[model samples]
Target: MPDDARLLSHPFDDDKLREECGIFGVIGVVDAAQFVALGLHALQHRGQEAGGIVTYAPEVGFASARRFGYVRDSFTKASVIETLPGSLGIGHVRYSTAGSKGQTQIRDVQPLFAEFAMGGCAIAHNGNITNAVALKRELIERGSIFQSSSDTECIIHLMARSIQSNIPERIKDALRRVEGAFSIVAMTRSKLIGVRDPLGVRPLMLGRVGDGFALASETCAFDIIGAEFLREVEPGEMVIITADGVESFFPFERQRPRFCVFEHVYFSRPDSVIGGKSVYETRRRIGVELAREAPVEADLVCPVPDSGTPAAIGYSQESGIPYAMGIIRNQYVGRTFIEPAEHIRNMGVRLKLNVNRALIRGKRIVLVDDSVVRGTTSRKIKEMILDAGAREVHFRIASPPTQWPCFYGVDTPEKDKLLASTMSEEQMRAHLGVDSLRFVSLDGLYRAAGEENGRDDARPQYCDACFSGDYPVSPADMIERGFQLKRSA
Candidate 1:
């Protein structure tokens, strides 16, 4: 949004899913914007491209600061934070799902604002609305002038046309017509509000940061600000918080929840809890499940580092292979999933990762990683390991092969671009040049996530559409555009 890409940092491609966004909101606090900043900082892994905060004060009114950079850089500046003064506020950290359609990229930064006939409200949203393009076209046909190309902006346009008398009622009126995943944080003059989609495909939690109430995309934000973890905002629930306390409503037809399974596998912070389970514990157990389902002999179990560390530890403990750091990640390297220009992606793994030849030489090694989207990273790593004199290199992926692209907000490669979409497991192993490659079974993934009896096909406990192609919500936009929306056989 700020046009800083001219600095020539890098382009992107990651062997993992691209995260969408993080949102934080607070009311009943003296420095509401600052608290929101801390919460967004804790949730930074969710989105990192740009951030904005909007606050309201009776003495001043609604004020906002949106910038294209890290939270610490944008929201932490005394000059920036001072401009936004209020006791109730909301904030958002965004990753560009893709490019916007117009020149108002600066306006696209959120917590997006709108002035209603009743009053003005500012909102920040996570997850994609599948019917956004259709809704936007319909809105424009009715003469709605739009400021941003974001799907979230569609919600604002719909709100402007609502006949409702109150902001919350108007919000409900607006959301009723949209479909797909959403977890929103909004600030009216005096209240902070939170909402989760009917299916709860994304995570949003309620907490108490003091006498004041708080809401965030993850519990890690509550931990960061010393808030007490309350509970999740249930599927289809809307919450409005004020000094009076919290009010809840069921604004949509209730359905069996389908929380995103990939959040437990890779997206969420290890310290955060989702649906009563620790993300780190879930990932670690996934590794244990992999060891049980796909046992292999190896000199040492080694992780790709950081995201792969917990699972590798579990694999080593379960299989009795000592774990080692066979690869070192440059901690300073920006996340690869955010880049897309082909030249930078083709530059490969050497930019962000390096092989620890001393740990890998002459020994059979098992490499534990979270997921493999294109097989490029895996192939590159295989070459590096072989060149380093490793006798045998086996790969153990913590999640099932991601054969289908996600339409629920994750920036997955297209179906045709997904390696698993076209290759058999044996074929993938050969292509990556690995002696063997194993992925945790889908049912095993369920077991790891605390579903004791494994997945319930009658009503699966999680959203695993990327693996099973069982989309709970119809991807209407993709379908209308003729992407042939059909489930995998």
Candidate 2:
């Protein structure tokens, strides 16, 4: 039951940049759909708008259910999972990025299914195809009918028209023609396939459960389902898993991996591991780096809460400043910003966070946070702190200023909307009405992420394109179509 009329994930939260999608797949298990449901639930943080699961069973063939809402609500019902009886399954959790046309369309919700020349296949994609518009035009010219307004559908059309001899070969042919970040999981009647693009801009990890193989966007999914974490699906590599075993192929030429750095800053479960580094550990290290780079003599160090907690702990430990929960988030107030009334929306930060005036009053505070986009959140937070009688407020950001908009997957605001893109540090400080604002340097971030040698100017280890405008994958569609990049990105 795909729901095209489903609502957005609190439009007010659009300011928070989000990962495009999350995928989970499992092969060689009875009730595989259950595993997929649990895995998708664990990955709910990555996407909150919609969830779908596609399962294949000898008795039932392929059964799918896509619904708008949380995975726990959409896929956890016994009646729903019972309908998807299968021994092989793949699931997708999706959140639309900004400019995502027809965002509520159920047809765009995936693991999009298709019947190709090779066989029947269902695909779930985790990254944007930068050249999708161009390829879509070419495919349309050659008479391919597109069912959904999604770039992931382009691969389905490409695979259908390929002259390749097998399903895997056709998939390779399709992937080769695509550009930008992608971590895909697809299922055929008897096989499960996982692929990561050459640069590995997105994350895809392999795992094992009992006698089965699993694939997921994050290790946290594997954790929820009690699976053993295996190595990551390597850059430019694909693994085809059948009942007998798994076979590997590297159809695309390999390149230096430029995994998204923001994954550590805000995405991914804190307990999860990426490239062997603990996400929580990296955040703490980032706080340590921030303390070293910008030491402030403040009465207390307070994190912005939730996303900022781990880094705040690190900053407190490294700088010897006691950390206090000066502002507490009301977990129950999930989407207070959704109030359509202007006065309610104007309430803003107070709706979600309440100032602990007892802890904050008369305190000189160092507020630790992840990143500043439009500075609206920071400005609101600063006003809240001052209203609580804070003597001074200094802002310490964990990552470098976000200047470039993320085209690969994140829903970042355009260049002109980004405060850092237009304002200098001093200007931003005055704009946020803070005594001072300091963002961790790019090299500091690399170091916290375990790039001990610092960033290699010629061959960077990670994609800091949001902070540094060095995009590894060319934004072919956006550039060729004249998507007005700042200073010719």
TM-score of each: 0.94, 0.96
Model 1 agreement with the true structure over 447-477: per-residue lDDT tens digits: 9999988899879988999998889999999
Report the CA-based lDDT of candidate 2 relative to the real structure.
0.88
lDDT of 2 by residue, 9-66 (tens): 4423444667878999999888999999999999998888788999999887899999
**lDDT for 25 (candidate 2):** 99
Q: Pull out the clashing pairs in model 1.
A: 12-339, 12-340
By summed lDDT, the worst window of 10 consecutive residues in model 1 runs over: 1-10
User: Which prediction has the highest lDDT against the true structure?
Assistant: 2
Residue 103 lDDT in model 1?
Answer: 30
Runs off by more than 4 Å, candidate 2: 1-12, 98-103, 336-342, 484-489
Superposed by TM-score, candidate 1 places the C-alpha of residue 307 at a distance from the truth, in angstroms, of 1.1
Deviation (Å) of 341 in candidate 1: 12
Residue 311 local lDDT, model 2: 93
